[model samples]
Target: MACGRFKELMMASLDGEISAEDRAQLESHLAECADCRRELDELSELSELVGEIELPRPSQEDMMKYWPSVYAKIERGAGWGLLVIGVVVWVAYGVFLFITDPTTGSMTKFLIALPVVGALMLLVSVIRERVNTSKTERYKEVER
Candidate 1:
C-alpha cells in the first residue's frame, strides 16, 4: 500500500478494526517511510488525547439562557421567514425548470406544473422544519 493508504490503515488499526493483512501492510510501509511513521505517531497521540478528555454538558442556567430569545423569535412571527424561504426556493427551482423545459408544453400544463412544483417545495420546507424541531427537542432533553 502507498503512504496515503498506509495512513488510512494506521487509523483503522488504532481503532482496533483493521484486518491482520492490512495491519501488516501498514506496518511494512511505516518501517520503510519516515514520513508515514511520523504521521502515525502524531495520529496515535491525538487519539490518546481525545480519549483522555471529558465532554462537558450544559448547566440548567445555561440551558434556560436561550429560552427568551427563542420564544421572542417565534412570537414575532418566524413562520413568515419559513414562508419567504419556501417561496424563494420554489421561484428559483421554477425558473430553472422553465428555462430547461420547452415552451411547447400547453399553458394549462405549465400552470398546473407550477402549483405542483410549489406544493412539493412547501412539503419539503415542512419536513425540514419538523426535523429541525426534533433536533432542538433532543438537545433540550440532553441539557436537562
Candidate 2:
C-alpha cells in the first residue's frame, strides 16, 4: 500500500474502526516503514492526550437566552436599514423639487444640490471606512 493509504488506515486502526483487510495491510506497512510507524505512534499519543481533556459546558439559562439575543440583533439591523431607506427617499424628493421648480433660480438650485451632494459624499466615505475597518477586524475568524 502507498504511504498515504497506510497513514489513513493507521488512524482507523488507532480508533479500532478499520476492517480486517485494511488492518492487515496497515500492519504490513508498519513493519516495513519506520517513518509511518513513528507517525502512527505520535498520532496515538496525541489522541490519548486529547481523550483526557474535559471541556466546559454552557448553562441552561445561557442556552435559552441565545436565540432571543440573536433575534434582537436582527431586529435592530432591520430597523436601521428601513430608516436609511426612508432618509434616502426624502433627500431624493427634495432634489427633484429643486430641479423642477420654475421659480427657483439656477444659483438657488445649485446651492440646494451642494448639500445633497455633500451629504451623499460623506455617507459614501463613512460606509467605505466602516467596510475597511470590518475587513481588518479579526472577530469573524473566532466564529468559525
Candidate 3:
C-alpha cells in the first residue's frame, strides 16, 4: 500500500475499526516501514494528549461578551456587500446616462441618486433584519 493508504489503515487500526485481516496487513507493513511506525507512534501520542485534556463549558456572561464583536463583524460585511452592490449599480447608471443622454447633465445627477437611495433602503433593511435576529437570539438565550 502507498504511504497515505497505510497511514489511513494505521488510524483505523488504532481506532479498533479495521477488520482483523486488515489489522494484520497493517501491522505487517508497520513492522517493515519505519516511517509508518513513526507516524503511528505520533498518532498514539496525540490521542493520549487529547484524552488527557478536559473541556470546560463557558459561562453565559462569557458567551454574551462575544456577541457584540460577532454582530459588528456581520454588520460590517453587510455594509460592504451593500457598498459593492451600490457601486455596481452606480457604474451601470453612469454608463446608461453617458450612452443614452450624454448632453443632459440632469440625467447624470438622477443616475447618482438612484444608487444612493437604493443603498440607503438596503442598509435600513439589513439593519432591521439584524435587529430582529439579535432580538430572537437574545430571547432564546434568556429562555435557556
Candidate 4:
C-alpha cells in the first residue's frame, strides 16, 4: 500500500478522531512503515506547537466592518466577469460584421484579421506564462 493512503488516517489518529477499526489499521500500518511513523511523529509535534498559540477572536463590531469589504471583493469579481463577457461579445460581433461586409474584399479582411489573431495569441500566451510563474513566485505579493 502507498504511504499516501495512510496520511489521512495519520491525521485522524493524531486528532483522536479515528474509529477503533481505523486506529487499529493505522497502527498496523505504522508498525510496518517507518517512514509513515516518522511523518506522523513530526505531524504530532507540529500540531502541538500550533495548538499552543491562540488567535484573538473578532468582536461583533469588527465582524460587521468586514462584511462590506468582503462583499465588495465578491461584487468586483462579478463586475469584472460581466465586463469581460460584454467586451468579448461586442468585439466578436464587430469582427463578424467587418468580415461579412460586402464592401470589404476577402483579401483585405484576411489581412486585417491576421494581426488581431496574432495579438490575441500573444495575449493568451503571456497570461498562461504569468499564471505558471505566479504559482512558484512567492515574493510577488499583490497588495497595492
Worst 10 residues of 3 by lDDT: 135-144
Worst 10 contiguous positions by lDDT, candidate 2: 1-10
Q: How would you order the candidates by lDDT, starting with the best?
A: 4, 2, 3, 1
Q: Please rank every candidate by TM-score, starting with the best.
A: 2, 4, 3, 1
Stretches of candidate 2 off by over 4 Å are 119-123, 126-144
| CA deviation > 4 Å runs, candidate 4 | 1-53, 59-61, 141-144
Q: For candidate 2, what's the RMSD?
A: 4.4
Check candidate 2 and list the clashing pairs: none
TM per prediction: 0.41, 0.77, 0.41, 0.57
| Candidate number of the best TM-score | 2
lDDT of 1 by residue, 1-144 (tens): 356667678889889999989988887887889998888789999999999999998898878878986888887777888888999999999777866777647686678788988999999999999989987775666654
At residue 80, what lDDT does model 3 achieve? 100
The Cα error of candidate 2 at residue 109, in Å, is 0.8
* lDDT for residue 97 in candidate 4, whole number 0-100: 91
List model 3 lDDT by residue over 1-144, tens digit each.
Answer: 477778788888877799988888888898889988998999989988998899998989989889898999999999999999999999899877666775767767688779987998999999999989987784565654
lDDT of 4 by residue, 1-144 (tens): 688868999999989899999999999999999999999999999999999999999899988989898999999999999999999999989988997799999899989989989999999999999999999987889676
